[model samples]
Target: MTNSTRCGECILPDSLPGVNLDKDGTCNYCRDFARKEDRNPHLSADERLRRLERLVAPYRKRGREYDCLVPVSGGKDSMLVLYAACRLLHLRVLAYNFDNGFQSARARENIQAAVKTLGVDLITYKPNEKLLDQLFKLFLTRTGEFCTPCNLIIQAAAYRIASQNGIPLILSGGSSRVFGGIQGVSQSKYADRAYFKNVLQGHVDFREAKRFVVENPWKRAVRRYTRTGPNLVDVLDYVYPGLEQTRDLLEKELGWRPTSDELEHGDCVLNPLKDYLQNRKWGYSEVTQSYSSLVRTKQMTREEALDHAEEEETRQPPAVLESFLNRIGMSREEFEQTKHRHFTEFPNYPQSRWYRMGKKAVALMRKVV
Candidate 1:
């Protein structure tokens, strides 16, 4: 494996696809941040609160059910979202937890604590474990990521819940602007419907694929026409008070506790396995992107980010790894084989050259317009 080279200004490494370093060793991401800063200064806390209040005012107590649906994984970020929705904005919230049966004990504790303390109704959803296991095994053997199924199911459930409950707003913790930089090369591969179908076709039978992997087309069509879908709002975009400020607030007000493991992935047992494989293949993991975000935002120094990155990227919890492998019915020997497989060998699902170029063009247009 080639040694990774990082941006001089931030921790975004050269190993990431589409990251280019200029003569100063600063990456394109840094330049983009600079340009964005010049065009739009950061919003103050008061301004953020005002904007949030305005956004939530129309939907507050609109129905008998709930004002907003906040997806919480018991992470600090999601906790902050719940806090703001309940304590600050005074919006009635329904906390949704999409459990894949890999939730950490601390995470579960935090989730229960947050909902109980905040007096928000809580709902937990888990997909069929047998089908979920088959899906994870398929993704692990076919591509490098097993989180694909989890992400897809989470979104689908969120959409379904919001539509069924008539919830107008779905508030999430963070956004691409916050953690997009450090994502590994595997992100470039498309994991849309076509990609999932192709992968399932190669392994599972048509009935199993239809039942487990595919979303109901008729339901989706009904949602589209009825305007029952909830509008997603990333709370960070409006009210990010930096990592330290958030942690302090959560601790003092909500009795929040940090997990014993790395705070980057919260309480998911499968995250370490995913990070390990990504680091093995691409020379970076979720830690890089997260700390890189902090560096770019000036919440953390590049040196400190580098130190944290080194520790997180190289370390994997043994117990979590073992549990994840056993759950997916894969042996450590099979996991080791994945290290030799490159990301490019997998089918690029949603991302074509033209698609990437179009995204770039759209971003540029948004900035200029």
Candidate 2:
């Protein structure tokens, strides 16, 4: 592990499963980051806020039940979006939270406090517990990773609720600068319905598909673009005041509290376990990719990122691993057998080229708008 080659800029290593390094010792992920960070033409803060208003205005029409739907993870970014929707834009908001059984207590507390204080309505959804546990076990055994099921649900639920309630907008708290993808991992992208259904083909029935899967988002994106359906906008892209300032506003204006729960990944318990497993398997995890992104964004210097990376990568594995295993009815020996497996070993249902094309187009538009 000590002899492994690493990206000159980020802590990403050549040993990580699918990462490819350049002759200069930088990885492809870093190159992509540099391209987006350096070339994108983003709007000024005020114009950006105006951009948000224009995008949201159609949904904020008179007599609308909700001006927009904010998916709350009880995290800082979501809280910022919720605050902006209500206080900043003067828009009516509905908050949605999903408990996949791994939500941290502190996160739950924050959600309760946030919706109550903001005078917003929240819909908390917990899918069938027994079935969700089964799905988690299947993911861990088959792919050596388990976040996909919940992640898909989180992304899809907003669309589902918006569709059902006649809500015209879904405001995502996702910040590329905050929780952006690092890529090159098994299941690096969220599996489409085709992929998810294919995985469940021989293992489990897809009868409960509606509870966990989202249909082709490209089609959804088209609907959004044609101005015919709900728009799942990344609201933070328009209004974020960078990390520290956002945190200050979260704490001061909304009474948001950072938990002492030692939680990471938006205070979700499962992420620490994933970080631990990735370190054991590849000698590093997405934590390195994530923090390295912060370094590139100048949110943290390379020196600080290296130190923080080591601390996160080296910390003792949390007890959640055992608790998670217990809840999923898996034994330690079975868990050990699954570690060497990767999700890429399984077949991915072919993705639409249009989705990729449309995503690139939207990313560019967000900046130029």
Most accurate candidate by lDDT: 2
lDDT of 1 by residue, 230-260 (tens): 7778887788777778788888888888854
Across 80-177, the per-residue lDDT of candidate 2 in tens digits comes to 88889888898888899988877878778888888888899999888888988988889888878877788888878887887788888888876667
Give the range of the ten consecutive residues with the poorest summed lDDT in model 1: 181-190
> TM-score of each candidate?
0.86, 0.88
- Candidate 1 has which clashing residue pairs, if any? 182-289, 190-349, 190-350
Error of 2 at 143 (Å): 1.1
lDDT (Cα atoms) of all candidates against the true structure: 0.74, 0.76
lDDT (C-alpha) at residue 162 in model 2? 79
Alpha-carbon lDDT of model 1:
0.74
